[model samples]
Target: MEFDTPVLDNHLHLDPENGRGMEAVQDFARSGGTHLLVVNKPSWTLGIDVDEPADFRAAFETTIDIVDEASELLGGRAWPVLGVHPGLVSHLTERGFTPDEAGELMQAGLDIATEYVPSEALALKSGRPHYDISADVWDASNRVLQHALALGAENDCAVQLHTEASEDLTEIADWATERDLPAHRVVKHYAGGRLVGPMPSVMSEKDRLAEAAERGEPFLMETDFIDDPERPGAVLGPKTVPRRVRWLLDEGFDDAVRTAHVETPRRVYGIETLG
Candidate 1:
C-alpha cells in the first residue's frame, strides 16, 4: 500500500537473534520505509540487565561496538538511539558507577556504536522509569539525559526518552524544551504511557492518541504486543499495527499520526528505510 507521507518507524528494536544484525535494515529501506530508529532497551531486547554478563563493562562496550558496526553497514539507512534503561538504572547504580561515570560510559558506548551505526544514529537518555524512588536518582537520570542532549546537539541528532509513567510526560517535555530541542524531537515509546492498567482495549488507545493530538504532542503506538496462551499480554498481532494506523488516518490526522510513527522519528534518529 502506498502511504501519502514517508513511513518512518520511530521505534524499532534490534534483535541479535534475527541474524540480520544491521544488514537487514537495508531491506527495510527497499520496501519504502524512509527511516528507522533502533532502540536498545535491555529488558526488552536481552531479557537481562544491560549491566549483566561476567564482563559488565564489556557488555556495555560491546553493545556500542556492534551498533557502530551496524551503522557503517546500514550507512544512511539506519540510526541508533542508545541509553541506559530505567529498569536497568538500579542495576547500574548497584554497580557503584557515579552519575558522572555512568554518563561517561554511555558516551564511550556511543562513540564506538556510531562507527558501525550511522553518525545520524545518536545517543539518547533511556531507562528512566517511574518506580525509581530516590530524588537523587532523578539527578543521575537527568545527568545522563543532559549528556545525551549535549552529544546529540554536537552531532545534530535527536534524543529519544522513555518515562516510566504517563504523568511524567509533561515533565519530560519540559526537560527536552529546556535543552533547546523541539518537544517533538524528544521521541517517546512503548505506549509507555498507554498501557496504564488492566487490559488495553482498542478504545483506550484511541482516547490517548486523541488527547495527544489535541495537545499537539506526539503519541507512541506499538505493534509488538505478544499474545500467549500462557501470557496473553505479550503479543501484538500484525492486525493491530494497521488497525491503529488506520484509526489515526481515519480521524483525519493522518499527517500527524504518520509523523509520530515514522517521519519525526526518522528525522530525529537519522534512519532510512530499505524495501
Candidate 2:
C-alpha cells in the first residue's frame, strides 16, 4: 500500500521538559512532514511542583510565552493551538478552586479561541458530562465562546475543542451556522472514541461526523493521544493514526480528514499548504 507524507502535523507538542524540541520536530518534518501545530500549556499548569502557588503561575506564564515566541520564531514552519487542557483543569481543582470558578476561567480561555476544553469536573470524571454549569457560568462561557468565534474569524484561527460528547458541540455548530461562519473556522480537536463514549448514541462521534458532513462543518483530526498508559484517556497510537485516516478515506470522507488536518490548520496559521 502507498501512503502520502503529511504537509502538516495538525496536533503536536514541543517541550524541553517533555524531551520534544526543535530538533525532534525538524526530523519528523524532514521525514515527509511540512508543518506542525505546537501545543503549549501555561507554566502554572505544567506538572512541575504544583505543590506551590508560585510554581503554578510560572508554568502558566511559560506556556503563554512559548506560544507567542513560537508563533514568531516558527513562522511558516509551525503554528500554535492554545488552551487550558481538561486534564490540567482537573489538576487545578484538586489543588483548590470552586467548581464555578474553574468553569468560569475555562470559559475565559475559550473566549480567546483557546484550543482545548475542560471535558468535565476535576478527578477527571469525564464519564459524567458537565455542560450543566450554573447559569452564571453558562452565560460567561457563552460570552467567551462568542468572543472566540469573532477572534477566530479575524485571525483565521480554528477553535480546537474537547467535549464530553458530540452533543456538547451542537450549540457551537448552530452558532456558526446562524452567523454563517465558515466551516473551517472551528476545528473540533480530540474528537474520537474517547469523549464520544463507548456506545452508540445521538452524541456519538459517528453521528457528529455525519452531521458535520451534511452541514459542511469543518473539523481537524486529532488523536488526543498522550504518553501515559495508566490513564484512561485518548491515546494516540502510531499505527492507529494511519488506520483512522484510512478508515475516513474508506468512508468517502478522505477530503474532510485531509483538509482539516492539513489545509485548514495551515491556512489559519498563515503557513504554506502541504503539496
Candidate 3:
C-alpha cells in the first residue's frame, strides 16, 4: 500500500542488539510508513547500569545511530528523541538509590540528553511513572519531569511525555507553560483519545483515530512499537500507523490523516518538510 501523505510513527524503538532492529523498520516502510521519531529505550534495556550520568551517552548514541541508519533506509525522515526514561526512577531506587538521588540522577541524564537537541536529537522524552508509587518517589519524578520541560524550553524542542492515562493534561500543560515550552510541543505519548491539553500522539486504534478526526483537532499518530523480540508486537506493531492511516483514508478521512500524520508533526517537531 502507498500513502499520498507521509505516515509517521511518533514513538518507536529499534533495538539492534536484542530485537528485530532495522528489520522492524523495514516492516513499517513496507507498510507505507515514511517518517518516525525513534525514541531511545531505557538505559537498562541497553545493558547500561546507570551508576553515573555519562552512562546514558551510550544509549543516546545508539538511538542516534539507529536514526541515522533508519533515515537512510526510510523513504522520508527518522529523527531521534533521546532522554532518561521515567521508569529509571524505580530502577534507581531498586538499585539502592534514594528517591531524591534517583531524581537527581534522572535530571542529570536529561541534561546530557539536551546537548544533542536540534542536532543529533530532535526531541526529549520524560515523564512520571504511570503506575502507583510512594508520594516521595512521585514528587521526585515530578521534579525530573519539570527539569525535562525546562530543557525543552531552553532547547526549543518538543518533549514527549509518558505518564498515567488521563483524559486531561491541564496540569502538564501548566508545567510546560511555566517553563515556556509551547503546550502543543509537549506531546502525550500513547494517548488513547482526544485530550483537553497538550498535544496527543494518539495510539493508532481505528476508533480513537476516527474520534480525533471527527473532532477536527490537530493530533499525531504513533505505534510505540517496542521491537522487543521477547514480546513481539508489544504495545503495537511497527506497521500500525501506516495501516491505520490507510484505513482512515479509505474511509474518507483524508483531511484528518493529513493533519495527524503531516501537519501536526511538522508544526510540533519543527520539521518544515515532513510530508
Candidate 4:
C-alpha cells in the first residue's frame, strides 16, 4: 500500500526487540511512512536497573546511537525522543531508591539527553497506567517532568509525554503555558479520540480519529508500535499508522490526513516530509 502524501508515525521504538530497525524503517518508507520518532524504552520494560550509573550511561549511549543510526538510515526521516521515562521513577522507588534520589537520577537523564539530543524532541514520558508509583514517587516523577520541560523550553523543542489523558495533562499544559514553552510544545504522546491538551498525537480507531479530525486542530497520529519481539506489535504493527492514513485517504479524509500525518508532525518536530 502506497500513500499519495507522506505519513508520519508519531511514536515507535526501533531496537533489536523491534525487529531489524533499519529494515523496519526501510519498509515503513516503502509504505509511505516519511517521518517517525523513536523513543527509548523505559528500564522496567527492558529489565535493566538504571539507578546504577554505568547502566544509565550505557543505556542512554546505546539509545542515542540507535536514534542517530535510525536518522541516518532514514535520511533524516527519523528523530530521537530521549529523556527519563516516568516509569523509571516507579522502578527506582521499588528498588529502594528514595523519591528524591529517583528524581535526581531522572534530572541527570534529562541533562544527558540535552547533551546528546540537540532538539525539542526530548521526552518527559510519565504516568502510564501500568506503573503503581507511590505518591512520593509520583512527586519525584513530576520533578523530573518539570526538569525535562525546562530543557525543552530552553532548547525550543517539543516534549513528548507518555502520560494519561487526564486532569494532569491539563496541569502540564498550564504549566507549559506559564513557561517559555507553550502548551502546543507538549505533544500528548500516544493519545486517542479524547483530546486533552493543545497538541495530541493520536492513536485511535478510524471513527474516533475522524472525530478528532473534524475539530481541525493540529493533532498528529501514531501507532505507538511497541515492537517487542515477545509481544510482536503489541500496540500496533509497524505499518499500522501508514495504513491508517491510507484508510483515511480512501475514506475521503484528506484534510484530516494532512493535519494529523504531515503538517502537525512537521510543525512539532521541525522536520518535513514528502507531499
Candidate 5:
C-alpha cells in the first residue's frame, strides 16, 4: 500500500481541549496516514450550558481557540478547517436567538473566521447536518452558508459543507454556481455515492468508491471522525479511510487512490501532497 501522493485524512474533529485529540491523530499517523485536515469545534460544550447566551458565547470562543490549539498540535502536519457548524446556529436558537438572529450571528462568526484564512485556516467547513432543526431554521442556516461561500470566494479559499446526503447536492452546487465559485472549491462533506459537485468527503462504502471513481472529477475521502469517547468510532475511525483506500489501491484502482486520496484534498483543502 504505497501512495504516490500524500495520504491525507480530509475531515475529522480533534478536540484540542482534550489530550485524546492529538492521540487520535498520532494513531492515524502511525498507521501510514501522511497528514490530516481537522475541523475545529467545541463539542465539549455538549454537557455545558447551551441555554445561556453568555455561556454559548464563551463556548464559541473556545471553539475558535481549539483551531489554534490544533495548528500547534499537528505541528503544521495538519491544517485547520473553520466555520460556523450548522449545529452552532441551532444551538443559538435554543439560547433564545431567533432564526434570523442566529443566521446573522453565523455570518458574523464566518466573517471573523475569514480573517484567519490567510493566517491560520486551511479552509472553511460550512453546513453541518440539520435534520433536527426546523425548516425555517434550516433555511436560515443556508443563508449563513451563503455568507461562508462568499467569504471563500473573496479569499480564494475552499469550503467543505455539511448537509443531508440525498438524491444529490444540487442546491448547494447551485449556490456555488450562482456565485461563480469554482466547482473544485466546494466540497460536499459526509457525502455518499451520488455527487453534485467536486471533492465530496465520500463515506466508507466500497460501492460508493467505485461510483465516485467512475465520475470524471476526483472526490475526497473522510471518516468524519467525531472523536468522542462516549461513542468512539460512531461513524468510522481515523484509520478507516486510509486502510480502505489502501485496499482499493491494491485492487488495482491506483487512479482512484491518487485522485481521491491525493489530488482532491490538495485542491479543496489546500494541503500539500506531502507533509
Candidate 6:
C-alpha cells in the first residue's frame, strides 16, 4: 500500500550485535515505513555497568550511530532519542547502589543525554518503572522523571516516557507544566489508549489505534519493537506501524493516518520533514 503522508514509528530499538538490527528496519521500510524515532536501549542491554554517568555514553552513541545508518539508508528518515532507561534504577540497586544513588546516577545520565539534544539527538527518553517497587525507589524514579522534564524544557525537545499504564496522567502533565515543558511534548510510549496528560504514542493494535483515532486528538503510533532475538516480536514487529496505517486507510480513517503518521510527530519532535 502506498501512502501520501509519512509513516512513522515513534518508539523503536535496534541492537546490531544481539538482535536483527538493520534487518528489522529493512522489514519496516519494505512495508512502507518512512521515518523512525530510534530510541536508546537500556545500558544493560549493551552490557554496560553504569557506575557513573559517563557509562551511558556508549549506549547513547550506539543509538546515534544506528540513527545515522538508518537515515543514510532511508534518506534522512531517522532521529535519535537518547537517555537513561528508567529500569536502570532497579538494575543499579541490584548492583549494590542505594535507591538514592541510583536516582542521582540516572539524573546525571539524563544531563549527559541533554548535551546531545538539538544536535545528535532530537528528544529524550526517561520514566519511572512500570512494575512494583519500594517507596524509596519510586520516589527516586519520580525525581529522575522530573529532571527529564526540566531537561526537555531547557533543550526545547520532547521527552518520551516509559511508564506504568494508567488511564490518566494528569500528575505527569502537571509536572511537565511545572517544569515548563509543554504537556504535548511529554509523550507516553507504549500507550494502550488515549491519555489525559502526556501525548499517547499508541501501540499499533488495531482496536486501540481505532479507538484513539476515533477521538481525533493529536497522538502518535509506535511498535515499541525491542529487537531482542531471544524474545522475537515481544511488543510488536517493526513493520507493524506501516501495516497498521494501511489498515487505517482501508478502514477509511484517512484523517487519523495523517495525524498519527505525520502531523502529530512533526509537532511533537519539531522535525521539519519525515522524509
Report, for every candidate in turn, its global Cα lDDT versus the true structure: 0.49, 0.44, 0.91, 0.70, 0.70, 0.91
Each candidate structure's TM-score, on Cα atoms with residue i matched to residue i, is 0.62, 0.56, 0.98, 0.88, 0.85, 0.98
Tens-place lDDT per residue, model 5, 195-239, is 755557788678777777767467887888887776774877877
Q: Please give the TM-score that candidate 2 achieves against the real structure.
A: 0.56
The residue-by-residue lDDT of candidate 3 on 1-275, one tens digit each, is 67778888899899998998889889999999888899999998888999889999999999999999999878998999999899999999998999999999999999999999887899999999999999999999999999999999999999999999987989999999999998999999999768988899999998888888998999999988997888875789988888998899889999998898778987898784353
Q: Taking the tens digit of each residue's C-alpha lDDT, what string does model 4 give over 60-103?
A: 65666676666664533666677667777766777888999978
Which segments of model 2 are wrong by more than 4 Å?
1-5, 19-27, 42-45, 48-76, 86-96, 103-147, 154-156, 177-183, 193-219, 227-234, 237-262, 266-270
The sequence of per-residue lDDT tens digits that candidate 6 reaches over residues 1-275 is: 45777888999999988999999888888888888999999999889999988999999999999988887656338999999899999999998999999999999999999889888999999999999999999999999999999999999999999999986999999999999999999999989767899999999999899989999999899999999998984899988998999999989999999888778987898775444
| Clashing residue pair totals per candidate (backbone < 3 A) | 34, 10, 0, 2, 1, 0
Off by over 4 Å in 6: none
User: Which runs in model 4 stand beyond 4 Å of their true positions?
Assistant: 17-20, 44-47, 52-54, 71-76, 119-132
Q: Of 5 and 6, which scores higher on TM-score?
A: 6
Model 3 lDDT vs. the true structure? 0.91
Across residues 61-170, which tens digit of lDDT does each residue of candidate 2 receive?
A: 45445444444433235444554454434544656755555555554544433222221100000111245544544454455455555555544445544444453455
lDDT of 1: 0.49
Q: Between candidates 3 and 5, name the one with more favorable lDDT.
A: 3
Candidate 2 residue 18 C-alpha distance from true site, Å: 3.3
Task: Write model 1 residue lDDT over 1-275, tens digit each, in one string.
Answer: 34454444445554545334444444444443444445664543454444422323333444455555645543244445655555455656677966655555544544443343233335464536567557766776666666555555555555665555454456555665676665555655555334322111122256666755555544545443222234435434323444455566778877656556555445554443323
